[model samples]
Target: MTGDVGRAIGFAVVGALALLAPLLEGRVDDRVAAVGTVAPFVVVAAVAYLSTSGPLFELFARPGDREEGRLYGLASFSLGIAGLAVIYVAFEFPVSAFLVAVFALTVGNLGQELTARYTPDPAVGTSAFAVLGTIGAVCAMLLAGVLGASVPALPLAVFVAASGALLGALIRSVLFVRDDSLVVLSVGLVVWFFLELGLAPTLRRVGIGIALTAALGYVAYGLGTASVTGMLTGVLLALFTVVLGGFGWFVLLVTFFGLGGLASKYRYDEKLDRGIAQENEGARGGGNVLANSAVALVAVVAFAVSGHVGVPSAVFRFAFAGAVAAALADTFSSEFGGLFDTPRLITTLRPVAPGTDGAVTWQGVVAGLVGSAIIGGLSGVFFGLNAPGVLLVVFAGVVGMTVDSLLGATLEGDYLGNQGVNLLATLSAGLVAGLAALWL
Candidate 1:
């Protein structure tokens, strides 16, 4: 009975957090409000009840689950209060308010994790995070009830309850079970903002651009081949900017995508580790002509479509094509360098053994050049560039690859985590490409 009582209190706290936080952000309204209010409290109650049942708790949350639950609830409630305060101070309604709301919710959620020290179990952790979010929503509404007596209190209260219940039970299914996929989705969301808001009006052009880049991922993950999700992300970003009247965006996109492509493809056959060792880890191989060819093919398609089809039609096709080209070129050089019988130091043509970082092989060099030519040609086709513009993009890719190698050999590893390295490299390549476009 004591255990039951503690569990109930814990659940009530979680419910409070979930219900108030989202509403304070103005994300909750009449429809979403209902589920939001009632769900959190009910979920807390359900989880609490299960905690007192030994087998049930063990099956769901493991040993110390009950204690962990209590800590999580309390932390959520406390943080939610803090978040509400922050929201009140941050800014006016709509955008600023939304950000503040999200900010508070995010902070409170992080606080719960810090306070509880719960292990990273996707099923348990994510659900708990969602519940923590609910607490923030509830708290916000409660504050409103106290201060702005004009606000309807019942709706806010009920919304908190329902959202908590649904989120508590369904979070595992919605986000936790496929954690890696969730990360990927999160990355996409982040990328979307970079393209849409950071760049400009090009957001409308994003549909095709996103589809095309995502297709590259599908080819790699779904079809069992290498891919460059990074390049795709970069290209989509730049193209979105370009469409929206962004100046000098093209250079950054091309240079970075080019460099990222080269870096990413180094271990074409290996799994995406993204761990620490990836700087110089994995087996290498020969260049893939088929892959490089595809790169060129995509680049050409994009350039032609963008120049001729108008920004709307061309944006997606061109961006996607560029991404494909970058992916192919990068993968070809990286993998091929490993298989070269006589690798040479990229800094000096002196012979070095395969597997040496920053080493270039004859086959890899050839593959990189071919990749640039094809992708650049595609750009030419779209932009209707004379020989000079076409040559410039190709030159950018070739030079960008070398610069990428230099960065890889020296500075990039220190600043960027595995993923950050990829982003920086792509940015560099795109910058170079844009400059070349201007000059030639």
Candidate 2:
């Protein structure tokens, strides 16, 4: 208990000390500001290398505190350095905004640790931490700005606080299951993304993303379609589509989600009896949600950042459609393919069990193609994709599913996880379609 409080205080102190670089934001060049943000972490990392088993490691966080006995503090220093560089150099945010953003993220992280340690209920603890952290961050940011930190617009301040609270809560929920440093870095990047969102779209669109995501997430939770973490995780992914990629992309994702969910629910009893059902009665968890959508998120972000014109616009549009199409094709292949009794391995063409990895059936192949066409046709309507673009999207989806089966047959069970295969398949589909559009 005491350790938790001590760690919280340590975070607060370190976060404050880290602000010295940002204070140089206006006084120096942006590149220099970026370099300055990295310098402190470099020094800390050296000291950490020299004294891994010593006092500072134990003070912030030690190995075995999170996952696989990893040193989260060292992880934080390394990731933080890289993340701050992107924020300072790539984004070129003003000093005040950078200071406030980092302050909110750091405080939100520490607050979660402290609250979770002392509070009995995990849900209650995290919620309280989010609320209290928001208050602390807002007040402190205002005070800092007033005291020569930097001037901040009221709306920007609010955006920073909301991003911290919402993204912090979502990230904190996963910390108990994995390493904290990556989670910390994720929060930083997410907050950065959320902050940048303010510049691109209207506040009304942002609100629409938040409101609709919350509503759908709550409905999914109430309908027992997803576990708590799954729903929360989906909310963030949905926001990325809606807020960054626009309505067309968001609707395509919804189509994939709806179809995939229906397919999972199809023949549930038979799959369970055969010992091939999705885990937890098809209720999605964080891993399941991330596996299907991470590549889509990347595509959406690329589209959002590319200014939505010319070949790049066409490329990302194809990329987004291909990713969704691939995801749906894979889902259809898995859920529909399992219905057949004898399946042939994609690599060997030998008979395998109904649910065997790399197993493909004639029924599954047709279903997968149909799934891809549905998305491809929708892409034509939504993204203004012409005939060639639509065909390319469908072809890319088929290729992605084939790649998925190939990987599953070869490496999935022994060397790679199922989720990793899914991510790779979507990535490949996006790359193929995007590059094709780029070249021809």
CA lDDT of each prediction against the hidden true structure: 0.41, 0.72
Put down candidate 2 lDDT per residue, 182-247, tens digits, no spaces: 454555565555566544556676667667776766666666566667766677678668877787
lDDT of residue 207 for candidate 2: 66
Superposition error at 308 for model 1 (Å)? 25
In candidate 1, how many clashes are counted? 69
Models 1 onward score TM values of 0.47, 0.71
lDDT of 1 by residue, 1-440 (tens): 23433443333344345335334334446445444443454454445443454544433342344556433333333343333333332422222122223323343344335434545443234334444544554455456555432232333232322233222223223343213122222322332232223222233343333344334333333332222222223333333334432233343334434444345555444423322122323211112212232333333334434544444433333333334344445545655545557777777767865555566777887877777677667666655656765665666566556655665555555753333433344444554554344343
Evaluate model 1: give its lDDT.
0.41
Q: Kindly provide the TM-score of model 2 when superposed on the true structure, using C-alpha atoms.
A: 0.71
